[model samples]
Target: MITANPAPEAGTEARTGSSPVRAVTRRKKRQWLPYLLLLPVVVAELLIHIIPMLIGVGMSFLELTQFYIRNWTAAPAAGVGNYRFVLQFDEASGKALLHSFWTTVQFTVIVLALSWLLAMAAAIWTQHAFRGRGLVRTVFLVPYALPVFASVITWSFMLQRDNGMVNHVLVDQLGVTDERPFWLIGDNSFWALIVVEVWRLWPFAFLALTAGMSSIPAEQYEAAAIDGAGVLRSVRWVTLPNLRSVNQVLLLVLFLWTFNEFTVPYTFFGKSAPEQADLISMHIYQNSFVTWNFGTGSAMSVLLLLFLLAVTAVYLLLTRKKDVDA
Candidate 1:
């Protein structure tokens, strides 16, 4: 008691005052750490993708051609001229662009329908347990596993009109045609492109569907069986309902990928593609590189991008409605 009110413990007072402040500081640092780590990725994405896209958009609004190719900055501004020219079908060039776009749409629709069907069938078939199931699954994935370039090149060789395995079997063995049809030229090129694309894309759909199938509860199928539901009915009522979300996403992805497809057609048909198989991608390529009309090519690309965005928005809205109804 003689300690003159016993000096307030200085150390304890300091600890109590600073603890809250220290905690708040640590939390702020922790929160900011993830953003700091992601800074590099954001910057890389901007530099690689966004910047080029902006540049292309800018180029679309300018008259960039071989005439001004040396110095693109000095190219005259075209404003909406390029877009108008592309959209108007009265002109010969515009007609060609429209035709190419229609061809692409047809190809995308056909490929998407066939690929999705085959993949779904394969996925459902492989879901059931059986001897050699693992082997079958692996075999199903081989087309997707192989390098696209090598596989496409091999297909190109095999599709040759003169001395190719496809024609060999059709003509020599089966006597389907007296003369070897030109698979890489004229209208048949479209069919050849579709066949090759279906082969490559179905495997991807198979993989996606298989993954989706794995998450489906086994009890659902069991209940269906107990209710005396057959395999087809079970699929229609149970399996499809469960796989709806997956299929929605898968269909959208396939549509976008197939619509923008370039490599398969390009590799199959080099600098020159037949009118029947001249996809929008190759059309843009020819406009930009072969014809040296960068401005028109950029405009076409921008239009295609906008169209795809609209399609995606509509698809999502429709799918969301279906999900809500379900």
Candidate 2:
């Protein structure tokens, strides 16, 4: 005999039956809400970051007017021609382009070296407690903390050749009596510009590395000493190894930051920046804004971004391998 529907359990079957639909509806709602929330962020990024990047890349391959929009009637498919002109220093493109590229390379390397070295040294030296540690740390950071343009202006004032404080101290007060050296006048004033970058950046590196050094165990050093290691030896063996990751990250970050820093060098030297200290960002600025060659500026931006990406990739590869090996 067919059993009549078993006497319905109180609130059990109905609850169980509805639970699936409720769960599915909840799941669907949760899924849709996230995408909806994400929509604005994604769209914002696309409009601000992604769109500009795509436009830059597109502009790199096309000839264009001073305004940057490709002149449809006269525009040519330049392919890699623009890049070749910049990189290969095509005589047809003129000496200015080659000077820009070489100077950029020089500036990048010098800034990277000086900033990292001084910062690491300062970080290590300051690891030992002394009076004024906090004050000194604040002092070191002040350069980077200052507004870029303001700092540049201040530095320019300090380095001025004629009535400049630097010249007065060196020539009249210090009794050097040498002709005053122009800080921003000559094409070889790499020194002036380099001082600005290193001064601004070392504090950042110092902050990162000093904190890393502090976290390292004191016992490790004591152990190393017990094993007959000197201070330098212990550092090479223990400190450097521990610091590798931080060093790697800081180096990469400074590399990118220094490479892209525009305001300091530009404000200090403008278009007359020493061939040795001019950088990619300045090149782009001059091409896009000074000359209003937006198309070429956009192209330069694309190349600079690609260069930065390559650097980032190298950093990732090196750090990943180190982690794996460890």
Candidate 3:
């Protein structure tokens, strides 16, 4: 006689049927896990950057001076009046802004050229195996590693007209100057700013260039040497060609940073930096905080933002085109 098969237990059947559903639920959760992890970062960016930027753009359209600062929302709308006032080149405010822009352009070009030159030289010098190469590399990084406030403040002291180390070296030690020339004022202030900024900036460039050089094969240099290539020729052909991508990114970052530099000038000259050394960033600060013209300052800031965006777009476009052609 055939034995009757026992009926499957109800709970066991339910568990067996629900296993696929549970697996589907777990898979759905895993699919959402990455987005959930990214949620906090997105929220933080919106809160810290996007919201504040929108507020600034809104304030740019309002007359948000000291008169309406307490109740900024109630301030009368100025529309494009602020932009017009700042862009009117014939007026004093416009003239000052134009001067600051040109001065910043000149400063940025000088700093970029000098910093890149020094960094490239140092990177090439340290590329080969030699005695104390590691020590030299460490020394090169000191300026970039130092705290900004501390290093720049020290430079401020050294650039002082009397009893500062710079003057002491130039006048007393080297006899480079007959008198203790003022370094933190007048036309000299521009050079002083350049020196301090170049000191602070070149180390980072050196680090970047050094990293790029590491990816260049030793055989390339050897081949160049066999062809009677000197150091300059080797760099021109082997090193620089290999480092095109790195240099493109490095130069763009340096330009943006130098263009928007604020802390160095503000710290070196307090609120009122000399006209010869007045950068656009400090000029905006003067308009906004010193003169309490928030609307005009905000307008200048928007113009600056637009200008930077345009420049960046053009730079990226040209680089991308070159990359495609290459």
TM-score of each: 0.90, 0.81, 0.89
Could you give candidate 2's per-residue lDDT for residues 160-262 as a string of tens digits? 8887788899888997867877777665377788888888888888899998899999999999999999978987998899998778778877887877878
- What pairs collide in candidate 2? none
Q: Which digits, one per residue and each the tens of the lDDT, describe model 3 over residues 1-326?
A: 11244455634422224587875566556757767999999899999999988888888898888888888888899999999999999999899999999999999999999999999998998998899999999998899888888899999999989979999999999999797899889899999999999999999999999999999999999999999999999999999999988888899889999999998998888768999999999999988987787888888998999999898889988987898898
Give the per-residue lDDT digits (tens) of candidate 1, residues 1-326.
11324575644332224587875566556767768999999999999999999999999999998999889999999999889988889988899999999999999999999999999998889998899999998998898898888889899999988889999999999999899999999899999999999999999999989999999999999999999999899999988988887888889989999999998888888667899999998998887898798998899999999999999988898888877887
**Which has the greatest TM-score?**
1
Model 3 lDDT at residue 299 = 88
Number of clashes in model 1?
Answer: 0
**How many backbone collisions does model 2 have?**
0
Best by lDDT: 3
Compared to the true structure, candidate 2 yields what TM-score?
0.81
Task: Give the runs in model 2 whose Cα sits over 4 Å from its true position.
Answer: 1-37, 67-88, 92-95, 270-276
Q: After superposition, how far is residue 36 of candidate 1 from its true place, in Å?
A: 0.8
